[model samples]
Target: MGEVGWNEWLSMMSSLAVVLVLLGATLFGLKKMGLSRTKDATKNLNVSEVHNLGPRQKLIVITINNEQVLLGVTPQAINRLGNWPEQEAVDDLNQSIDINQLEPDFESPSDSPGKFQQLMSQVAKRTAERKKH
Candidate 1:
């Protein structure tokens, strides 16, 4: 509550700097250990769809090592629901089957970038092309 003197202000700022450095080091360590939630998801284990049964229960379809497996996840544990047939030549751009038909319980939208983002990128590309021309 009282006004801080010059020395006290410098001491407080130094302490804050130390705390921030330690926090940054801890976050870097966590990222290196693959514990950061913001870390990119595993390339081999890709989530194809998710069905939320309740607040705590969900059925997830994840493609692991080219095989899709249905998983039932709860607060307690995760169980295998079933296995899906292997897809052929499927990519982010090309999908043969309708994702909605695969799961009736929940509507699974495509994971491709949103239409607005795509349109903006296209506009930017055309503008750059026009500038170059």
Candidate 2:
């Protein structure tokens, strides 16, 4: 194969430079138009927590526009499980009794079932109550 000449090298470099300039300009234009992801655009929406239920299922808590929303996510669908106002969520967090305290006691096998049932019932009750308001 023939060696590349100086002119060929120069032509290749110039073409590369032109392509880089175009790419940069496009990115800059997109940012100016607010088409690119920016803090301001996402300030009102945030994922607060995520819990994996199974290999293909998860529970996600997100805060949007001052409301907290619980979502059930599966491979095929996303469902809204519950919603609460931000103030209520804050009050719950500030309470002396933590929700984790109500979780099943892993150390005592016999206590686990009853505690788990209590926790599930409380969650169901809370969801139902929130739906009414």
Candidate 3:
């Protein structure tokens, strides 16, 4: 390429400066509008639970100001399920599920059991056997 003259160099630098200014202004506008991801988006609400009903349906439980609400979500729309009532704390032992109590093939387990669930089941079985003896 031919040598860049002083005028060409100055023009190139001015163009770069204009681009930087526009980028900075866009960032500033997003921050002012509270649309920047750097700020905590869930400061006022907490997602307590989520259940997948089907490919396009989901159940989401959200907590805000110590109140919990259940929401049904689908591709088309969102609907309120109901308000979940807060319960008194219970012991962990009472919350434990017995593997033997689980129904055999309630649905096809091979469908969507992810790696984490598989590992957790293995761990739970080992722990339960250890507790038995």
Candidate 4:
């Protein structure tokens, strides 16, 4: 085998560093660009919300308790939130309700938040505030 030269080692290292830097830059650029194409949820979007988010955007529908709740913006509304307490509560609730027993032909939103429900809730909350005054 030929003698290993210091210049060759430096050259190899320099090329590797450049490649790594380029890869990192590309990855960073991609991440910064927001590759997640999923549109913001629709259930909770109000007229004002739409105005704030700009017009003509796709929205996702979410059902909570058989009721449809429109989560506002894409980045604003999260599907899976990190909540340890909620997880535990869900596990406990699961233990109480047996899935096999409550067989149903169709699934509906029982507690889902509809547009009216949101309005009503807001009104009720405002009423309570007025009462406190």
Candidate 5:
């Protein structure tokens, strides 16, 4: 009985090893055939953003090969809406902002020149009043 049990245990281990080997080979084959998710396959393609427009519709921004693509996607289909060079998009964004507008004028009253400063001052006053009460 002891010898029989030892043989059965050895047989089960061998079968398990064979199954693991087959599984590993199958995974390797799938990866080589490009049917498995692999980093090399998507190294240059990136989904930058996704915005849901409805329950079944979305706007997707994807970057591929140094170009940005805008896609409109729904349950039924995916459509390319537009595309632009990534560098051109960066340049356009930089050109849209004026450096001078972002600088706060120090000579003016603390609250007069910038809305952010004014809002901060109002917040400070409210907090001071709250502390007094």
Candidate 6:
């Protein structure tokens, strides 16, 4: 700032100090008012009452082979099978027929390939090798 008369400088400084004090007081007041709502919200927060399970809910009740399973399932197990994208049920249905006879066939990644396609791949490899030479 440029040098001003002492009286003008003091007056300008006083005005600036007043503005800073007013701003601080307004901010403090807003924070004080906001605390009431914050306290009210805290009082209204939801609390899940996780207590002892009842008779039916205690067991995971799944019938695998005309018999019910008495073991309780974890939340992680339920979360894992929640989504069924693609033809996953088809996999279960496809394996249902040969469950006892060929259990090895199920869950195995298919390795079958067309004969002509394999021969074409070999020809392409030979052509690439000739180009390299």
Question: Residue-wise lDDT of candidate 4 within 1-133, one digit each (tens)?
Answer: 9987999999999999999999999888977886545645554432211112223222233334333333333323323211123333333323332223433333342333343234333433443454455
Candidate 1 Cα outliers beyond 4 Å, as residue runs:
1-42, 88-133
Reference-based lDDT, each prediction: 0.57, 0.67, 0.59, 0.41, 0.60, 0.38
Candidate RMSDs in order: 15.9, 8.3, 10.5, 15.3, 16.8, 23.8
Q: For model 1, what is the error of residue 55's alpha carbon versus the real structure, in angstroms, after optimal superposition?
A: 0.9
Q: Using TM-score as the measure, which candidate wins?
A: 2
Model 4 lDDT on a 0 to 1 scale: 0.41
TM-score: the better of candidates 3 and 4:
3
Error of 3 at 98 (Å): 13
Screening candidate 2 with a backbone cut-off below 3 angstroms (N, C-alpha, C), the clashing residue pairs are none
| Candidate achieving higher lDDT, 2 or 5 | 2
lDDT of each residue in 30-109, candidate 6, tens digit only: 89777534455334222212211222222222333332222322322221111222234333323322213322322322
Tens digits of per-residue lDDT for model 5, 37-133: 5446448888987765446555677889999886766555576766778876565334332223334334433232244333334433443454455
Q: What would you estimate as the lDDT of candidate 6?
A: 0.38
- Estimate TM-scores for all models: 0.41, 0.48, 0.40, 0.31, 0.42, 0.27
Candidate 2 residue-wise lDDT, 22-123, digit = tens: 999999999888786544745888898776644655567799999998776655557676788988877653432334544544454234334434444555
Q: Between candidates 1 and 6, which one is better according to lDDT?
A: 1
Worst 10 residues of 2 by lDDT: 108-117
**Predicted candidate 5, C-alpha RMSD:** 16.8
- Tell me how candidate 2 scores on lDDT: 0.67
Q: Is candidate 2 or candidate 3 better by TM-score?
A: 2
